[model samples]
Target: IGIFMWVSSTEASWQDFRKPCIAVVDAKTPTTRIIRAVSVVLLPFLVGFLGYNSMKPSTDEPIELRTVHPAPPASTKVHGKTFVLQTASNPYRVDDSGKYSDKVQNDYKDGNPWDEKAPQFLQYVREGGQIFFQNCHFCHGDNLNGRGMFAFAFNPIPANFTDAGTIAQLQETFVFWRVSKGGIGLPREGFPWASVMPPWEQHLTIDEIWKVILFEYWHTGYYPRTWD
Candidate 1:
């Protein structure tokens, strides 16, 4: 009880001692007096500035929470042709049955793509593989998982088709627009960005582009989402 009283009394004495007394301030020089006056006026603004900076979000964080499949335009033009995204479909996403065949697509994943007897869909997949290996492998890697030989050179590297966020969630037509337009494909009015992806339209034909997309789905076993 005595110890508690002593500590309380001591703390009260310290608080009394710390109380500001205007007469106690030693502004002996003109400069010292000016500095004190300026500090009195500027301290609140300085504190406010620091507090605001501390509370605000950073401009660059390396991590971005972005829509992997952003809303695509209703109609997009590429290579002297316009594709209506809502109605468009992947022509190569078919087998000998004349439509998508789950069994055929699954079997081709393990089988040789370069074989002479490869089914029609598999044949397109083979050609797509050729295009990917020739152009995309350096950045997307041989596995089409985005870790290519040249992948290390880029800050973000290429898109990993294996990830559910990328190819799996996107429509084939949307994918087509991205490839054809590359970095310039992003919505112009929404935000500003500069992508390193080359617009494939300048180099590859529409047929080649479709074939590359076909190979990607076959290799990954992902079907593009259909527009309802």
Candidate 2:
């Protein structure tokens, strides 16, 4: 009697477990048979449709990417003098009217700190390099390439001293005026000056400014303009 009871309970549990699976496809019931048949036919078609859609290429147009070129520098005249753009479109005119213009021009023409192999000239270049790294490197970069740490903060970006469009075409007097007066010295009649370059007259000695200029030309292998 005990064995018979245990076998009866086991059969009942098996029937309970199989009840759901049997109901899923009860062939005698028309509704269950229809659902099972529809699922068997439609599942493969649905999967195939999805797979086909996934494999198909997109019909959208390709995107075009054009290079963004910087605008050319504008030309302007200041106080009966013509000033052209140099180094990131900054307008600079030679200091032909200043007291020390001739002196600065003369020193530039001498060209010792760059072309000379003499010990004193080399020493001058060395001193200029020291000054540049100390004061100017933060904005102009160690390579004088103008891509300094703070360069991205400015719109037009810092002057690329290595570019031929910059120091290559400029006169030494131009350099002198820009360095001594900084942004405030820019003529009001010219393009709106918005640079943060401070007046170095209060900060750097005149001699130190000159030395840095020499170092710039020497380091970059660029020569100052011989003409106006």
Candidate 3:
């Protein structure tokens, strides 16, 4: 299949080329012979040194010294309102009694979000789900497990909510702060601004942010730890 125009004079200058090679090996003087011997000995060493250095591992990528979940600032300003992380709460996480308390939200855990008579908690969760699918789900995932289609596209990747080390360990207020401010609002510990999580306060209302937190907790069935 290799179509090449080959001439019949295959031996045309093959002998002529060998004449130079014979001259090198035809070392009549001791200095010439010594040079030939040294070349032979140094050639393999030079090749080996080059190959070893070329195959060595490179330290090209910069090391990341960022803190994923650095301690949140005690208070953060969102939509021109300052919220103290320790005291802030998700106002939408309420039951029929209209307030979040011990196991009250669990009553509406199986409630139907589509029903007109659906409990307030479920309705808020539904609204949050809508907002999440519209804006947040691309990176946070449909299941909120941080496996969304565009999850790994970011440097640190999205948070896996199903993991105990993430949402389960943090307070809802902390999540509120994070949602409202996003990665850009993170303290100096989250250096280099590698996180692409957009500050939601710019795009969503504070209530919408709270509802999203409710939906996340409800979907994962993980109670957000309280500072108390």
Per-residue lDDT of candidate 2, residues 1-228 (tens digit): 775566457778667766755876676688778777777778888999999999999997555432122232244333334445342221111233323232343344445544445345555667788888889888889899988898888756678899888877776546756776676666655535556677776678767877788778777877676543
In order of TM-score, best first, we have 3, 1, 2
Lowest-lDDT window of 10 residues in candidate 2? Answer: 87-96
TM-score against native, each model? 0.68, 0.49, 0.73
TM-score of 1: 0.68
Residue 220 CA displacement from its true place in model 3, Å: 0.8
Worst 10 residues of 1 by lDDT: 16-25
Give the CA lDDT, 0 to 100, for residue 67 in model 3. 60
Off by over 4 Å in 1: 1-67, 97-104
Per-candidate total of colliding backbone pairs: 1, 0, 0
Q: What's the true lDDT of residue 22 in model 2?
A: 82
Clashing residue pairs in candidate 1 (N, C-alpha, C atoms within 3 angstroms): 141-148
- Score candidate 2 by TM-score against the native: 0.49
Error (Å) of candidate 3 at residue 164 is: 1.3
Best model number under TM-score = 3
